[model samples]
Target: MVIIKYYKGVESNLYNYKAMQAEIKNIDLELNELKNEYNGCSSISYEEKAAPTNKFNSSVENEMIDRRLKPEQLKIKKHKLEVQLQKIDNALETLSEDEMHLVELRYFKKLQFKVIAERIDRNEMYCVCLKSKIIKKLIPLIFLLDK
Candidate 1:
């Protein structure tokens, strides 16, 4: 068996794949909230002093620019969530059904190797080795999509 040393971030992403999925869903909700907030205008109005120079300045332009720029934090967060989601999704897609099932049993369901082996009609050692192989297979796919 080969021992693979993954970068900390990649390893975390792999082990926490389910958590990342949940986070992606949360990010989607947050993005929707931000969208609604951006679209819904405030009723209260405040007065602003005119620009000192003679340049034509309007509150409408400022409001437009603010609206465009204000969601940058959410946009960046959404983009990161997208990349993580894509990495996990693409990796999972590449797996065969049995391999996916093994992953579900181990990662998603958090089964012990003994339980997984019994469920799959395999020995505990075999299950452990298979999990290593599956993770090795997944690492490249995950990093490939990171780029």
Candidate 2:
């Protein structure tokens, strides 16, 4: 089925748009924090490189026994989060004003539908319906954009 696209300012609400933009900022902040943590652990200065490469196993094992297991796991987790953050940012960019607003309120802000409805002046049922439809549209867009 073909989806209809709305023109700029067409059935779009300003409050929703602003809400989304703000939520995007929060996601960005969170993404940056994750990246910073990842960098801290993965840094390689010349001094660090002075050690034998094989030292990694001993150092890592020591850290693990001291309750710092999974250095590699942290890297993988950071990578996954980066991918997820990119998808969310790209999806936010592609959304129409209306859909973007709905997604921001529901997912980004982590608001329940009833609360979103109250804020946006819509019925909760309608907000939930719109949210589901917007999510459906965004899912593949995110996947394609990430690829």
Candidate 3:
């Protein structure tokens, strides 16, 4: 099997991680908004107890039903986000020191391979080889696929 690994681009990956986190936060905010809307509807119905009509109760019931459904959906989303977070953490852990430094220089510092190699007192080709290996290591760790 041709194991095509796209390694050494840690900046984009880290940015992707941050984007995922932002998405998770956005999801949380959406869930909270839904809950708050439900609560407002529910409380208003209760507050209007003296009004004699089935309309208020029915509206409140609809709001409650929505509240019930939303939480279940949010729970599923939260679980998926948690799994993604775990994968990112695992990828970070699996990196060797050299591999990690290479990634840091390449991604965080925005250094070219030649510059990175010069700073580290190595050839650019050496960085390329190491980066390829690092990418291979990261792929399985991030995807949780069979190696």
Candidate 4:
């Protein structure tokens, strides 16, 4: 496939795949905490006021609303992360075993090119070229950058 345009931040997104997975785990923990915080609490409450006015709300009330919405926000974030993860996963699935290993060594393990070359039994130049090709291949798969 031909790449018409090099999408900005594709390299960074590829490099940060492992970090993104870790973030998803953290989000899960946060969502659990939020859920536990509101467990057994009344979902409905009644408040009496002198007049039925909705013009303004107290800071406390606003904070409470924000807190209540926290889990939904977190869920949205988690879903985004999951989608990115799925894209990366699908891209990885398309790679050959050697390509996958190169990606794991270079990106997931954060290895230097020299080290990766040594590990993969290839010359440094070959490793560099292969890495470039892999990134190009993945850009289309991961980002759907092909037109």
Candidate 5:
């Protein structure tokens, strides 16, 4: 048995975007969970009567600030990922139809070469060779997109 793993063009960026999306979802879930914890804790006072309410209020204020920061950070990260995905899409648009189809199947749709060959009615070796050529053509396009 043998295994070969390859990803080209915007494949990595797409994977990263997916991962960041999952992270954002997790952060959102955490924030929702924290909301319940926050409500529950609000009923109790810290350090009892001797501690001024100002101290308790400040602590709660600080906690709120910390809680807000996570979602804001995740939002920024998600936006950046979206920008990268957009750039990838623009680069993809410049390719010839055949090349674009190959790239889409390989990268965007994450299809194996054998499956792609079957779908496209070509031999696997031909598909492999064509993908190499497609990647060569995309190199300059990808660079241009970065500008």
Candidate 6:
């Protein structure tokens, strides 16, 4: 579906809140993979040589520096992603349960309003009105451009 967004005063077309959450989720997944790699010690390992050697001998005997990220670096990255996810979670927590549910169906699940109404056992118009309310509530929390 087509989505439009305006940053500052210029008009740009894209979904914002959903994309933000999606990015956070992606970062979390990446962090998990990094953690698994650290735990498994699967990252490449190498020894450093103190002095230069003959090119052929060095190439044969000395492996290149691992160039792999240290586990500590992975931990730092994971911590940062977790902190960002926490911020997003805190912002989402401002909504009531019902409002949050509607948002999840509409944006997260990308469900149609009619389907959302059916799932919630509400009339279509009621669902639309509720969505409007939810947007108003979320504007301050998610849509910084709205300010």
lDDT of each: 0.72, 0.58, 0.73, 0.78, 0.65, 0.57
Off by over 4 Å in 6: 1-83, 143-147
Give the local distance difference test score of model 2. Answer: 0.58
TM-score of each: 0.65, 0.47, 0.59, 0.77, 0.59, 0.46
Residue lDDT tens for model 6, 1-147: 111232221111112445545665666676677556423323333543445655433332222222244445555765665564554466568878888898788767778889999999998899889877655554445445344
Cα lDDT tens digits, model 3, 31-143, are 88876663444345455566677654566676777788877887798888778778767897878777778877876567889999998899999998887777777776776
Error of 5 at 51 (Å): 10
lDDT of each residue in 1-147, candidate 1, tens digit only: 223455344446766877867776776787677667643444433554454666544566666776677567667876887787787788889888878888888877888989999999999999888777777777777776342
- Model 1: colliding residue pairs: none
Query: How much lDDT does candidate 4 score?
Result: 0.78
Best by TM-score: 4
Question: Residue 19 in candidate 3 has what lDDT?
Answer: 68
Candidate 3 lDDT (Cα, 0 to 1): 0.73
Query: What is the C-alpha lDDT profile of model 2 across 1-147, one tens digit per residue?
Result: 222232112224222445545555665666556545532233344545555665564433444453333434554565665665565577668778877778767755778888999988999999978866665566566555332
| Residue 53 CA displacement from its true place in model 3, Å | 24
Candidate 6 has a TM-score of: 0.46
Model 4, residue 124: displacement in angstroms?
0.4
3 or 4, greater by lDDT = 4
For candidate 6, the per-residue lDDT at 135 reads: 58
Candidate 2 wrongly placed segments (more than 4 Å)? 1-72, 145-147
Across 61-81, the per-residue lDDT of candidate 4 in tens digits comes to 655786788888998999999
- Stretches off by above 4 angstroms in model 3 are 5-15, 39-68, 105-123
Model 1 misplacement above 4 A = 1-11, 35-70, 145-147
Superior by lDDT: candidate 2 or candidate 4 = 4
Order by TM-score, highest first = 4, 1, 5, 3, 2, 6
Question: On residues 1-147, what C-alpha lDDT tens digit does candidate 5 reach at each position?
Answer: 111122343345543545655665776777677667653235445545555555545556667776788657766875766666566667667778887777778766789999999988999999899877765555555445332
- Candidate 5 stretches with Cα past 4 Å from truth are 1-9, 14-59, 140-147
Q: What is the lDDT of residue 42 in candidate 3?
A: 37
